[model samples]
Target: MTTPDTQSCTACQDLERGREQAAAVRDRSKVTDFHVLIARHRARHPAADEAVNVMREQGPRT
Candidate 1:
């Protein structure tokens, strides 16, 4: 049986992983905000900026 402490510890580990990945991406490319990443991707990938902006406007859900 899983204890509440174990559940909390798992949640914290998942959150830490997410944060670490975000940090790694930012450190590798120097982009933090989603919108900035979208813009950079658009420039490099030559995708539509309007489409990227729309996706970016979705906020944290992106």
Candidate 2:
């Protein structure tokens, strides 16, 4: 399940997909790039950052 904000955020979806693809292929550089992009996104969107922190606290979804 995705939050309403996440579902509506194309940039977030794209970055996550890019990161997943990079990780699947063991492309550390691309993965790092996506992480950087996500960090930048979070810096600009405090709500998103907070959501991520909450999710982290909850741990991984099963």
Candidate 3:
């Protein structure tokens, strides 16, 4: 029930979300990527460089 254009549009949307999240993580301590929220709790906020690694390890939650 999906056309090629529909699939392409969905991919583009996902890419934008990823770019936005990357910028957010780089420039701030909070991120709202997908359902996983990353924030600076107390003084243990993750560094910008560690953001991607952290997210990869955490992955998606069911």
- Which number leads on TM-score? 2
Between candidates 2 and 3, the lDDT winner: 2
Query: Can you tell me which runs of candidate 2 are displaced by over 4 Å?
Result: 1-4, 48-62
lDDT of each: 0.50, 0.84, 0.46
What is candidate 2's local distance difference test score? 0.84
lDDT of 2 at 28: 100
Tens-digit lDDT track of model 1 for 1-62? 43333243444445445556777767634324443544444354343445568778987883
- RMSD values for the candidates in order, in angstroms, are 14.8, 10.8, 14.4
Clashes of 1: 0
Ten residues in a row with the worst lDDT in model 2?
Answer: 1-10
What TM-score does model 2 achieve against the real structure?
0.63
Q: Return the TM-score for each candidate structure.
A: 0.31, 0.63, 0.30
Candidate 1: misplaced stretches above 4 Å?
1-8, 27-62
Distance (Å) between predicted and true CA of 60, model 2? 42
lDDT for each residue of candidate 2 in 11-39, tens digit (9 for 90 to 100): 98899999999999999999999999988
Q: Give lDDT for model 3.
A: 0.46
lDDT of 1: 0.50
